[model samples]
Target: MSDTLTTIGFDADDTLWHNERFFALTQSHFAELLADHTDHETLMQRLLEAERRNLPHYGFGIKGFTLSMIETAIEVTDGHAPASVIAEILNAGRDMLSHAVELLPHAAEAVEHLRRQYKVIVITKGDLLDQERKLAQSGLRDLFHGIEIVSAKTPEVYARIFNAYGTGADQGMMVGNAMASDVVPMIAAGGWGVHVPHGLSWEIEHAATPEHKRYHEIPDLAHLPKLIETLTQGQINATS
Candidate 1:
């Protein structure tokens, strides 16, 4: 893996920082905003359905999620949702957008450690302006080789990013929290996928772990540097 992997990509949201928690908080607010119309459990289910239905149209991020909340509100309320409730949902989204970037444990340190020997970049999907703002506020931006705010993390997307960096799939690795977005696609692209499970993950991003030779799962970012070293040394042994 040492000789094969020259570029390492990180996922920005839940992988590097506390992102899904804010979304969970906002979802709680959204349920409250619509409580008069339906039960909390029912409303949550509807919101998840709405988000899934809207993913292709809106892609990923707070703006899209806010829109989904609005749509779900209208649907649950039979279009009688008051304008004030919509305003509150928008405010929730604004607050989320303005939320401070809280780096996860050892996120900065892991990136710093990896960058010394490999090309490191952030491959996150979200609103372009909002993603840029988060990256700027993250304070770890300077440690990355580049940032790619993508619409989706598909195999093609991984291929393109690896190619752009002058690396092949076998020569690139993706470290992230979402198996659907970060791990599976990169593995499909023939790259290594390192899954770092976060405390909270959006239901829309969940996928069953696949059995693959190049897939790895770690508890958190702190263990990443050691994992990389192990993989690198293993590759050295195989080639030697």
Candidate 2:
């Protein structure tokens, strides 16, 4: 919330609403589906590996994850997984897509508070259709000034977003749960990075804890406004 920070970007999924929890539940179901072929631990490992391998091709979101699960099932069962198992996996993905959007505690309050003082936007990466559907269902969509559903969250991607919004890197702040996709890359692009930890995180989105001076870690969304106030009032330097 430095004086220069005219725009604040938020990550949509876990940062604003309950996302990873659904994935975790779905994963458990997936483990169950493959239990006959392999134990839970090994199936989970295989699924993780499949996800990592498919990321570049399918990108991020439920569709890609569902496909990876199918692929993993095929591999684990030597391409002999039953039609019923494949159907279950597909249904799981559909259910996830249609699941109700539940906002995290204080998410609406935090976004409302920040919107009053800043040009708040959502910069999230995932399947465009699914992300858009979630935003539409979130009931917080109108609170944001803009929404960006991107293919990735690299530094260059962020730089373009900031440029499009007419905010410089130093004049932007990114708040989200993932250190890998949300905080570090945005910080590397010269923006302030605020990390709000979600209880569960996708393994592929994990990264080393950042130690940059411009990086800040807040417990949750409720603490955001105070942190912004501190930065803007010069009570603390953004680079501190």
Candidate 3:
């Protein structure tokens, strides 16, 4: 919350709102459906690994994720499962597409508060249509002054966003849930980043721990505005 910074970028999905729960629920089904072949913990690990490997290839979103889950289930099951099992897995994928995305607690309040003082924008990755649909459905879409739908978050992504907002990295801040995808790259681009962890965040996101001096971690969205206020006040105190 640098008052000097006119623009603040926020990550969509799990950051500002709820996401990943669909994947988690689907995963539970995977474990149960394939109970004879794999346990929940092992299945979870494999799914996580598969997602990591698939990120580069699939970018982000439900389509690639669904495919990955199905692929992993088939691979781990070794083609021995009955056809009905595969059909059920496919059905689960369909159900995920229809699952509703929810806004995290205090998200709308934080966004409303921040928008009054900062140029709020959303930076997120995923399939274009689904991401767009979720945003429109989120009811918080209007709270953001702008929307950035990125296929992936990289150092370059941060650079572009900073440049677009006409601010240097130090003047900018990124709020996100995923340490690797949302915070790390933004921090590398010279911005302060806040991470709000979700209970069912994607595996790839949970792999990295928050350790950078510029990186701050919070339990959930309810504390985000307070953290931003603290950050902004700290900067003010140092300058004074």
Question: TM-score of each candidate?
Answer: 0.97, 0.95, 0.88
Model 3, 143-176: lDDT tens per residue? 8877889888888888887778647656778888
Q: How far out, in Å, is residue 119 in model 1?
A: 0.4
Candidate 3 similarity to native, TM-score: 0.88
What's the best-to-worst order under TM-score?
1, 2, 3
* Model 1, runs deviating above 4 Å: 1-3
The residue pairs in collision within model 2 are none
Candidate 2: tens digits of C-alpha lDDT, residues 1-240? 234778899999999999999899999999988888899989989999998999899999999999999999999999899999999999999999889999999999999999998999999988899899999999989999989999899989888988788477678999999999999999998899999999999888889988887899999999999998887877345446
lDDT of 1 at 115: 92
Model 1 scores a C-alpha lDDT of 0.90
Of 1 and 2, the candidate ahead on TM-score is 1
Candidate 2 off by > 4 Å: 1-3, 235-240
Sum up the clashes in candidate 3. Answer: 0
Per-residue lDDT of candidate 1, residues 65-102 (tens digit): 99999999999999999999999999999999899998
User: Scored by Cα lDDT, where does model 2 land?
Assistant: 0.91
State the weakest 10-residue window (summed lDDT) of model 1: 1-10
lDDT of each: 0.90, 0.91, 0.79
lDDT, model 2, position 201: 92
lDDT of 3: 0.79
